[model samples]
Target: MPHPAAEHSAQETVPQAAPPPAPLPAPAPSLYDPPELNPGAWQRAGRRLLAKTIAEFAYEEILVPVRRPTTASSPVTDAPVHRAAAHENPSDPYAEYTLALDAPGERGAPREPGAPTGGGTLSGPGTPSVHGAPDRHGGATGSVGTGALPSRDGAGEPRDRAERPHLSFRARRSAYGHWEVEPDSLLLVEDGAAPAPFTDPLGFLTRARTVLGLDGATLGHLVRELSATLAADARLEHTGLPGSALAELDYAHLEGHQTGHPWIVLNKGRMGFSASDAARWAPEGRTEARLPWIAVRSALATYRGVPGLDTAEQLYARELDAPVRESFDAALRDRGLEPTAYLYLPVHPWQWDGTVLPLFAASVAAQDIVPLPSDGDHRLPQQSIRTFLNVSRPERHTVKLPLSILNTLVWRGLPTRRTVAAPAVTAWVHGLRDADPFLSEECRVVLLGEVASVAVEHPLYDGLDEVPYQYKELLGAIWREPLGSRLDAGERARTLASLIHVDPAGRAFVAELVRRSGLAPEVWLRRLFSALLPPLLRFLYRYGTVFSPHGENAIVVFDEQDVPVRLAVKDFVDDVNLSAQALPEHEGMPEDVRRVLLTESPDFLPQFIHSGLFVGVFRYLAPLFREQLGVDDAVFWSLVRSEVLTHQARFPELKERYELFDLLTPRIDRLCLNRNRLHLDGYRDRSERPHAAVHGTVPNPLHAL
Candidate 1:
């Protein structure tokens, strides 16, 4: 309205020194706070970006090699690494640029020991191909045609992009804020291009590293986001995948997230990874690096034809000690995503060394993953990881060892079931030395007594060795303790005998098994029982019927030939008779003593007496079979039947006894089924107990199975 002061003052005051403007303090500055998000939200965002990259790559399988001399029409897109197979062109060193997965001297090797291709049509040598195929058709057996694979996709549609591989991206983020692909054939880089191996990935990584300048903390955050998205995709494919894969996956992403690091991994074949151009060499790269004997054994075993197991554990130790899924589960529980979380390991070069054994075998065998063995050293190869794993959930990581030794240290054996038992098991080392004499060098029987004793004495009271006498006594007091149920049989007899004897081989076998089972949970336990125990018992006693299904006896362990770690318990010399048997069962044993304190059960005697001794001892072990200890299950089973079980058919004395073997069963259910049926007269009341009915008929427990 410009009324009062304006009307009078405006006319004369326009020159009034701008009304002596009042001095004002500046408003508080924002201090540049970035956008707020939930804790670790940045990681989720990074995962989304990674997922997008993968999704896009999956759509474009037409590989555009940076230097493979491919037509420009299919020029390299966003794809990373590329290479041809070893046998593609012998004339060109770059031909063996693809992955090589054959073992040092196996069938698919450049020169396997007994190659039909190496030998010629009988008299001379076979013709060798330039690089496509080594002429091994020595037998002139002629080329066996494999015909093209019937496309899994619909009959007419172009090979679906979905069916193609997720384009490989071996990336490295550098200290200089650039990302670069570990290009295939380091020697094949375009002559004019600068740092071709690192150029492919530089675009995306450089922009972020230079502009965003995230710290390790920021890197971790973004990587996690990428990991989550991939895991979600895997969840649709497999359920066994664990959430822990995220740690590996995210870290793997970071490896490629940069391009210009001082050090870069260069592939040679698939057997080795060199820290070439590294700012700092790896710990294992130090002079005189030595792995444990068991680890060496495990590495060789990993060389067997098995995947993830072949190199996953080894690489995990070498490059990244990815945390177990359980650890992440606990973290996520504290955060919110329960159960559905997943984790993955990045496929870096460390994964190519001994760790890639099985993968190498599979790739070559199936013509899926190719081999590119080096012409000179024959080690250090480029590597590739399948975008997806079949197991839906990630494995639980609980080896409890440093990343450097995790694979060999995988927790196995019954020892790992509880914490208290660990100390007792540890304490047994002293006892191992004590009982070394009588056991087979492989049994590890010498150390068991000590282990058991320590378990009983353990401050935590771990009961591996304890008899639970309180419970036993309680049952003892409550019932007439069936003559065979309370005391008279050798329960821990095999263990006892092993403890007393000092056979180094026997002791070693058992010791390794127990230790590994504690870590691996007898994953092969039930099968080990079927393979070893039955044959041994069959060879022991021939006249009486007997069975050795004692709870502690049935066991399993690792059988890595390079480094075997068996899991089952052998025989028991350190046995105590828990109960006496009826006169009927012990009628005609060789040992003069009528009331013999034996291990396992009376039912097992007949098989041993009939053919076990004659066949197993006389025919099998006496001759010494080698494949029995190797990894082939068929080989294992063949030995079991042909060497041991077959002997039963040859022995005429066992026909009738064999019938008894068919009817016998362990009394595992007696406690639950007969608890009230048992009674004791004139005895103090104790924990209520059960009884056995001599006349009752029992159905075969295995029927449910």
Candidate 2:
């Protein structure tokens, strides 16, 4: 049973003859004529674009202080919430901070009146109105919110108390709780303060244009989103105000309270924050509380909506919106929401990636490079373009894909063939059209390598060259898959669990996933959670309340048993937030340290916990199992929680050693409490909801009361 051949294909480097390869076509004469790939261009552009984008968020999401919090104690870096004050009066001057109203309506009027509000509706059928707090089923407690359920400042404690800074804004939880801010958003600087316009709107907009290479309309959309955030802030302060003119008010200031609200909690499998009420609580970060990537990606998607950029992809791309509400609704109906919560959030937050590179290549690259595609879809269409560096390598169809399928994707259009010395070489290549400018370099490489398929008795080695690089770029680009790839999707995903490096069980588990799934789509997940397994269950981590999980990225493949046999995960668009790179503690942990250090980013995990697991796996995947398997929902979450805890009990060393998991335990509980009940007042009123001024029509978007 020991297969020496089981060694990963990447490690098998046998010296052989290097076959002569066909000459590559000349590079295009124009349009980035500089033959150099300028891969650095991506970094530079990405940096500049990021700064400008940050600038766009300057007043909205970005918090700048004239000085450190007068009261913040040193050493504790966590963003501290305002503590309770001895003298408490809800009607005091310090209680009038800004908060955005929940923008109204069901999905009916896709087009907001006049200019667009940069807000999209995510409410489902028969949504109850907010009384003071919000109530409905499937809602989770936490700052991110449950539905468009209400909860805000004072829901916790006092945040900041100041004379109306002449700038106040309102932020409402769009259907799935992706916060939408208003551009040209007003500000209320107390009675005497001056509400100034954003000083650097153009500077911000231009920078976004350069970094993202966005067209006019895309840029415009971003600006609108920016403005909306500002406006929403204004609305929040204005709506809550009950004071006199500037002359009458001196030290009188508003100190909004949202102290009691927990930032995260687990609801069944879904993650919810203060979904409904933003104006009262979480105003400082209200404008852009969406799943980190969703906020940006939605902006990009909207940018493509602008005319004249000559970008039709985003204009036509169908996006899944609002898995939060969808999941909640499904929960009510005894059904499961679709499997992609991160991909389907209802609100259209700002986005930029889709308008750029991988956004376009998602399908093209995916279809072209995927060998088996899925289980039975092995007879893939040759139409999927293949790019090759040289014909000396084997064609994708002829190559032994093994685990390299992922590598091929990372080093897209690169070679996979392992080379030795070439005694006699013969290969033909032609696809890099000079004048015709036919295919992307990606295509040219794959096509030419396919041609090299001829004249090599070593049929396998013939296409080796092109395959390795492609495999490296695509698959080797990241670390988690390789780690997970080595495990079995089924048989209790806990085989290696956290023992990926120290224990042989970990290695064996990795081997199974690698062999069976081969980096396919959603297949691994199904295989992972069928039973009480650690590594299998650990694979289900999803984060935060954004509705949709990233789709163009994560992929899975199931075998003949209709379970995940091969799986691959892609896209770190939100890697900055979700990755574990920041936690230096992670590097010392078990598993592939180099891969984790070199490829895995810690930033993405915080975000992933919010986006991928909270929305994707918890909200999406678990429900899928409940529906398909016909099981109770809470039992599913309880089972997994029990397994993880039980495992921790079994291995005390793991609890002491893996600090990451140490930080992981209680988060699910915190996220589940009061997350759904947040509203205008400090405590929630789940018993009573808003009653519309008019019975026939739905409650006004701002106040169902």
Candidate 3:
């Protein structure tokens, strides 16, 4: 029996004559690789990234660089570096770079007698180093080739501090009162001093091994990750579009240009990607490839959806128009398969050839999995490597598939439990938002619901205990509602990540948006805070719920003038967290919703806001505003405090919840993500997903405000 179709869908409004897919190379040419990966491009990208790696690691307490006052007698090197004071000085051959440390570890002090003068130690739990290619058990890959894992010039040579042009040496008293700068740390000091246009991230990491206190294994792995990051940065730099130009691009195009998570230093280290794969599939590559869809036997796969979607046919009808649906069904029939017996889903082309073909060979040979022609809809990869934007049909839903690459801290695969529960969780969250008049009527906050999902269990790994999670999560897809059609006239949307983006010209994207808004910098900042904070605060206090409103998860909606007006949130099933303390608001939540949503204590609940939003985002944005807009740090933070206080005053009835989820603690838990990568896991697979390492604490900048 033919399934009844919905009257209409978002596709109805799509313009006639859809853009044809761009011509492909005979053997599938890379979008932009040859020119972007040039030596000069890699050098510029490496230098800038190396400076950031040092600054961020220091800020996070992963590396402790003892600060001493700078003096006129500070030994200077002939190595050219961008001076701190002039960030955008045209005469300076490099971009704005700052040297935060003063003198090296104390000079002329006993350096353990024959100890070489590098600098200081970055010490940690001394794990033994693994050399050469990492074993399958996740030791370390030897090097990333041109991505700069090892110094192309040479490796492991002990160059003294006095001889290195970028390094300056001065001894500081150690815990035992003897002064000596390790040879490795001395190189780090030089790199920071003469950074930008002349820095090497991989080389710096190798030299700083003693100071970093990293064992051979950790240092070698870190170098590889940094190298991959440099390669991505090089591609981004070669885009040649300033933030202003990037701003003018549509939402999908603009997403491809983002610089990625500001806090994670190794943000773009897609470990599984070769240089060719990175060029074709990585977001910064800006390649729009047609996706290949597959049909899986229903008996071998499970799917769940919200109220409106009850069957595979309903989902297909809602997502694809009548003509497209018929074409898909006919194609399945042509392959001598019963269309009704199989569920159709989009596959990431890379995954189709790499993991799926090898792991699911048995299923394919048995005719349980059948391939369909490319959908012909051009799609661009988003910042999250596995998710894709439907560029050919702008109003269509974004499709997310599992890519089994280990990036940042975890394998980039969707958990089967979460994938199956996504739609139901989305429904529960949407109901809560719609029930609140303020969220719906006043704020018009959009919840980009995950409408449907399919999870295919691995034949061998599904029921096995203690197997690496990557196997179980190997095959799945989620379809989320797009944000395009939801926007009102003259309104524009941008991810919160874009706000911190700085162009090659040293102009910030936020600064440009503010200039276009014609509002004073401080006033513009208040508007942004007002747009983003209230709904999030209300979710915590009124609904006993919170979201990981980090840069990518939270979107700022702007009006015709580019002044921020409202907030839009996404990534619900995986990121939304509920208060462990049961409240009246959650009484109606479905069992599946309860099972899938993470529950956190109210005391730690504010981290979703404090760490994800304030620290993750404002920690970086505040400084950018201070430098580019002349809004001092104090002033920038005061505006943020004002927004929180105003929200509190508006809902006095929820004052108890506000106190319970306090955001103004004197010190906040310093969650270290990189430390987790280096010390905790180090590219190894674990049964449980990785969590951020909480070192000690950072004095909360919001305290006492």
Candidate 4:
């Protein structure tokens, strides 16, 4: 058979009309400008991210920060006191400590230096609760530099003898003992550490390398990832959209504004993406590009769909209108191909040029894969880089294709096995939701099912167990039901990630929602907790299943009043896990389904909700609520605890299951995401995907309540 390109080239004819005037090249969008790449924004983002890294790492015991003694004479300065010179000799407990405090108009400045005149106790676990130390009255006291301290010099000068204030407290003890604090870099000083301001991530990591126990190789790679993360953060800062303005954006537009994964310091590190690629594909870029469709020969590709879409043609008909569908079919026929013999799949433009065209040259040359022109609506990238929402047709299914780009931990590709079984998996999950009265009638949680899918495995790599998993996952696409289709009148949907988004001016999207809803802060939060907690808790205890209800996977449905009404979840096949223990519920599950889904122990199941929802999101939002709404950290957690308790009470029959999948454990395993990148697997290809490293246990803030 003649090659498809050759057939098309033979039929091509020159334009009959006069050539149009030569047009100037279009200017590149600002998102392609290396994320502003300025010292001010980059360093600021780095320090903030470093602060999170220190807190979470220390919380996980990957790095332990010791407390330095503070006394009446030498009060905690508004800067980091270099204890390296003092503690350097290991044997020497005290040496001359140089305090690199924040100067006027810098972080950590202008306040009382000493502890309050009273007994001091440490705040309970997880990152230091210093930011909302309860006693701080929602003021910025507990963070690295939240405490008020008199300003020294911006150049790290010592305080004047005449301006020094009196020390109030004689002593205070905690896990991090009476540590003298500093500005810029959190109190991350250790023996032999050089005194410095929070300038750059690489510098901070270098100084604390010994303390962090990071090898040089790990540090180098981590710096690169952090550099990418900092650049993205700078871009977000440069957008200058306040939370209020951000809230006004459409769902797809709002996705572009979100700072991803609150806990992951290097969340935006699109390692394989060049600046140009990032501009065209990164969610932050907000570029709308039409994707071309490819017709893969049936012998080389496989597709599955729900009962309604029993055939690939049926799925295509529903996605594309009559005119567009005909155009796509005609394009294939013009290349001397029968449309019935091929499966149409939309391909990410970047994936085509970067991976498919070059890697699948044999298939293209053999005319097995025919590239068709983009005939449908333009789509916008979502927070998950590979997924795109149809902007022209809001009701159309969102398309997820295998991009083969290294992002977060794994390559952003759809696994062959998962892609093949996606529709079945969705059917099973949606079946449970539809059957359960609580889920179907009361909560009305929407499961945006992966209704159709196509998988074209690499002929060579598919059979190799030794090959990197990315290779096996490189060529597949999933079509998920759009959130817009499931919504009722006056309802809108937003990703859970948006709730915690705080803009450049430190205004939170949730706060804006609360203001718009005209509900009191505490009341509004209670409504949110009420909407999210019950349905998630019930799914675990009742069905022996759990979804990775992370920020991106979970969607919050809101009413016209801007109050959260219900939850909608997507990304099912890859993230949903079943219980390993035999449950009556699983007895009826299909054999093919059992082979593909992951089974986790009941103990580990709650982590999907705990680590994914609580620690992953609420941990960040708690402080924001404290600052914005005066809902004390303790009160905020109390509200969450109340919701969980209320749900447990409603389901008396699932008490045993609740106990088995305990959400109220005293210490839950701390899933260390960044640690996996830094130490466990440092930019090396692995046969399997990487997961969060459980370093140790952190105190579950919800345990007591």
Of the candidates shown, which would achieve the greatest TM-score relative to the real structure? Answer: 3
**Could you tell me how far off, in angstroms, the CA of residue 506 lies in candidate 1 after the best superposition?**
36
Model 1: residue 173 alpha-carbon error in angstroms: 57
lDDT of all predictions, in order shown? 0.24, 0.24, 0.71, 0.70
Residue 41 CA error for candidate 2 (Å)? 40
- Candidate 4 versus the native: TM-score? 0.80
**Compared with the true structure, what per-residue lDDT tens digits does model 4 show for residues 37-155?**
77777766665666555555444434323333445375444332233422121122322222222222332222222211111111222232111123211221121112123344334
Q: What is candidate 2's lDDT per residue for 1-705, written digit by digit as tens?
A: 546676655468788899989899998675322211234433332232222232222111111111112343532111222311201111112111232212222111222111111121121223222211234222321121111112222123232333212123322221111222232343323334475433233333342232122334434544544343333223332332222121121110111201111112110110111222222123222221222111112211112111221232231132212443343334323422232221111111111122112332443233211111111111110100111011121111121111111110121122211111100010101111212222222111111111111110122332345432322212100001111222344312111111111111112222333344454323344344332133222322211111112222333333344343332322221121223334332333323212222222222232333333433234333333333334344454455445456655655644433344332432221111111221121121222222211001111111110
lDDT of 3 by residue, 567-601 (tens): 99888678898898989989999998898898877
Error of 3 at 110 (Å): 23
- Over the stretch 516-610, how does candidate 1's per-residue lDDT look in tens digits? 33533123333343344443333232323232323222222223321222223322212212112343333433231223343334342332222
What TM-score would every model get versus the actual structure? 0.20, 0.25, 0.81, 0.80
Clashing pairs in 4: 79-101, 79-182, 79-183, 80-182, 80-183, 86-95, 111-149, 130-142, 131-142, 131-143
Global fold similarity of model 3 (TM-score): 0.81
> Could you tell which candidate, 2 or 4, scores higher by lDDT?
4
- Each candidate structure's count of clashing pairs: 134, 217, 27, 10
Candidate 1: worst-modelled 10 consecutive residues by lDDT: 474-483
